[model samples]
Target: MAVDKDTVAGIAKLARIKVDDAEQEALTKELSNILGWIDELGELDTEGVQPMTSVVEVQHSLRKDVIKDGDRQDDILKNAPESKQGYFVVPRVVE
Candidate 1:
């Protein structure tokens, strides 16, 4: 795909970037070079190749799920700077 000056100007407008008339020519050439490289990559053969998330082999260690929290309300409330009616009190913001 060839990137012209008008195409670069359109891209600049869409990205909300201000590109001067002098800079547009340089930018258009740079963008064209990048696209040419991408086109070269598309010509590679990848028959029977498996996609991988990472280069290294890894396994996650997991534990069994269990419910606990066994009644420690008074112990938790002791650390609070301000508590009211078994709950931590925060400063009111809304009127």
Candidate 2:
């Protein structure tokens, strides 16, 4: 995974980033080093390893689903500036 200056330039063009000759050289080295580290990680033995979302064990508590209309019309309508027939009264938008 050795990144060359031409590869760095192509990447910069695809990303729409302006990279001068000096910056391209620097980025080439950086990208090569990062890929080399990834290659090193690929060589490690990962047998009998379980993939986990978190290091600590967690138990999620869930409640029973129950649906019911909230019977608080008068209490809710009290907060409105104006209400008529158990509904908020707003100015007519259409002529």
Candidate 3:
């Protein structure tokens, strides 16, 4: 986890980040510490723990699927600027 300035620069180049020389030292130390922390986490004991996707359990309340005719064609066409034969009339797209 001991990241040097050269390693930091190489990492920045690989990640397509433009890290200046002044900031590289700070970034190197920060990234190295983060990796070290992740390494420290590997020492934790959780052999019997069940893997959970989320901390809170959620229940989705859903209504029964019912099918019905949504009859609103005439009502909808009433507000149109131009409608003919139960359809909206628009200018022809092709000549």
Question: Could you give candidate 1's per-residue lDDT for residues 1-95 as a string of tens digits?
Answer: 67999999999999999999999999999999998888886678878888787787878778778866668888999999999899999999688
Full ranking by TM-score: 1, 2, 3
The number of the candidate with the highest lDDT is 2
**Runs in model 2 lying further than 4 Å from the true structure:** 44-95
Question: Which portions of model 1 miss their true places by more than 4 Å?
Answer: 45-95
- Model 2 lDDT per residue over 4-95, tens place: 99999999999999999999989999999999888886787888987788877789789878776588999999999999999899999789
**CA lDDT of 94 in candidate 3?**
88
Higher TM-score: candidate 1 or 3? Answer: 1
lDDT of 2: 0.91
Ranking by lDDT: 2, 1, 3
Clashing pairs in 3: none
Say which prediction, candidate 2 or candidate 3, comes out ahead on lDDT: 2
| TM-score per candidate | 0.46, 0.44, 0.43
Higher-lDDT candidate of 1 and 2: 2
Lowest lDDT block of 10, candidate 1: 61-70
For model 2, what is the alpha-carbon lDDT of residue 42? 71
